[model samples]
Target: MKYTEEHEWIREEDGLYVVGITEHASEQLGDVVFVELPEEGSEVVKDEDICVIESVKAASDILAPLDGEIVEVNSAIVDDPGKINEDPLGDAWFFKLKVTDLSPMDDYMDEAAYKKFIG
Candidate 1:
């Protein structure tokens, strides 16, 4: 898994990259109330805003971690936004992308570095 400074996590599985906010981000956001996810099959560029998350404290955009086509979206979070606060890294993953080029995955921080970064 890799982590971005924006508090998003990236995990590659079966050729797709799964994206979700970190535990720290979930806590910071408070209880999640709403989620707006992008359509499946849509093309996305790295760093583009692709999803929205609303919490008791604030609303935030979830950025595309790499250029790719959105292969799948987890609508479960939309129906039950509180799931994000409950399990951010697992069942609360926002979406998965089928990136053609994976070189940029190298640019993100590893778990150890990300912990230090937040510190």
Candidate 2:
């Protein structure tokens, strides 16, 4: 898993990556009420805004952490935004990206670094 300073996380699986917010982000957002997901097969660039999450506290954008085609979206989250708070690292994953360049991941924080950064 890799983490972004923006509080996003990406986990690799079978050459694709599942993307979601970290638990700290979920908690900071208060209660999530809505989620807007990008289209499957849409091309996205690193750091581009791709999804929107609205919470009781404020609305936030979920940025594309890498350049890639969005291969899949977790509709379950759109239907139930609270899932992001309940399982941010698991079933609440927002999208799957087949990244064009993985080098950006090398610049992202590892678990230990991310913990220290959040601390």
Candidate 3:
């Protein structure tokens, strides 16, 4: 799992990555109400906003962890945004990307580093 300073995580498996908000982000956001997802096949660059997660406090942009094309989105979150607050690291994943390059992952945070950052 790789993390962004913005509090998103990207877990790479094979050549694809599953992206979601970190637990800290969900906690900070208060209560999530809506999630806007990118369309499948849409191209995304590293650090680009690919989705929007609206919480009771404010809407936050979900950034892409690396350059890639969106391969799938979890529509369950769109219908029930509370899932993000309930299980941010499990059932609330926002999207998947087919990574275009593995090199950019070097810039991301590891689990330990991310935990330290949040702390």
Candidate 4:
């Protein structure tokens, strides 16, 4: 898993990536109430806003940390947005992307670095 400065996280498997907000973000958001994910097959670039996560506190944009095409969205979260607070990095993943290139991943932080960054 890798993390973006904006508090999003990405984990890759078999060339596809699962993307979501980090736990720190969920805690900050204070109970997600809604999620607006990008349509599948839509192309996105790094740092672009691809989704919206609204909580009681504020509505936050979930940015793409790498260039890719969205291939799947987590419908489960759309139906029950609180899943993000329960498991932000796991079952609550917002979408999957078919990465256009792997090089940009190097710019993201690993777990330890991310922890420090949030601190």
Candidate 5:
């Protein structure tokens, strides 16, 4: 998995990339209460606000980790926000992206670097 300083994670699988918030991000947000996901087929640019996550403390934007067309969204999170805090790296995933440009990943951090960045 690769991550952004903003707490987005990206993993490529069969050409498309799966994106979500890291466990560290969910922890910071406390208990998640709402999730706003982008529509399928919507185009997103790197660093753009693709979704919004509302927690007990604050509402944070979920940034796109790469330029791509949204292929799918995890509606389960929208329906049950607690999944985000309970299984951030598993059932809490946000979206799947059909990537357009792959270069931005070169600037992303690996797990070790992301852990340091979050620290």
Candidate 6:
């Protein structure tokens, strides 16, 4: 998994990139109540806000970690937002992107660095 400072995580899977908030982010937000996902086919730039996640405390933007075209969205989390807190890295994933630039990943952190960063 590659992690951005904004707390988004991206992992390559079957040639597509899966994206979601880190568990640390979900914990910080308390409990997720809503998620607004970007539409499929939208173009996004690295570090730009592509979606929004709302919790009881506040709403946070989910940024794009790499430039890409949104190819799929995880509607399950939109319907049951609390799934974000329950399984932040798995069932609660927000979207998948068809990557356009691999260069931006050079700025992301590995799991260990991300853990340390949050700590």
TM per candidate:
0.97, 0.98, 0.95, 0.96, 0.96, 0.97
- Candidate 5 local Cα displacement, residue 58, angstroms: 0.9
Error of 6 at 91 (Å): 0.5
Which of the predicted structures, 2 or 4, would earn the higher TM-score when compared with the native? 2
Note each model's CA RMSD in angstroms. Answer: 0.7, 0.5, 1.0, 0.8, 0.8, 0.8
What would you estimate as the lDDT of candidate 2?
Answer: 0.95
Residue 85 shift from truth in candidate 3, angstroms? 0.4
Error of 2 at 94 (Å): 0.4
What C-alpha lDDT, on a 0 to 100 scale, does residue 113 get in candidate 1? 97
Candidate 3 clashing pairs, residues 3+ apart or interchain: none
lDDT comparison, 1 vs 4, better candidate: 1
> Candidate 6 on 1-119: residue-level lDDT in tens?
99988888999999999999888889999998989999999999987888988899998888888889999999999999999999999999999999999988888999999989988
Question: Of the candidates shown, which would achieve the greatest TM-score relative to the real structure?
Answer: 2
For model 3, how does the per-residue alpha-carbon lDDT over 1-119 read when each residue is reduced to its tens digit?
88889898888767679989999999999999989999998999988888998999898888888888998999999999999999999899999899887797788899999989998
lDDT of 4 by residue, 1-119 (tens): 99889998989878799898899999989989999999999999988988998999888888888888999999999999999999998999999999888798898899999999988
| Residue 103 in model 2: lDDT | 90
> Which structure is stronger by lDDT: 3 or 6?
6
- Name the 10 consecutive residues with the lowest summed lDDT in model 5: 7-16
Residues 1-119, candidate 5: write the lDDT tens digits: 89988888898878889998888888889999999999999999988888999999999998888888999999999999999999999888899999989998899999999878877
Which residue pairs come into collision in candidate 4? Answer: none
For residues 1-119, write the lDDT of model 2, one tens digit per residue: 99999999999999899999999999999999999999999999998999999999898998999999999999999999999999999999999999998999989999999999999
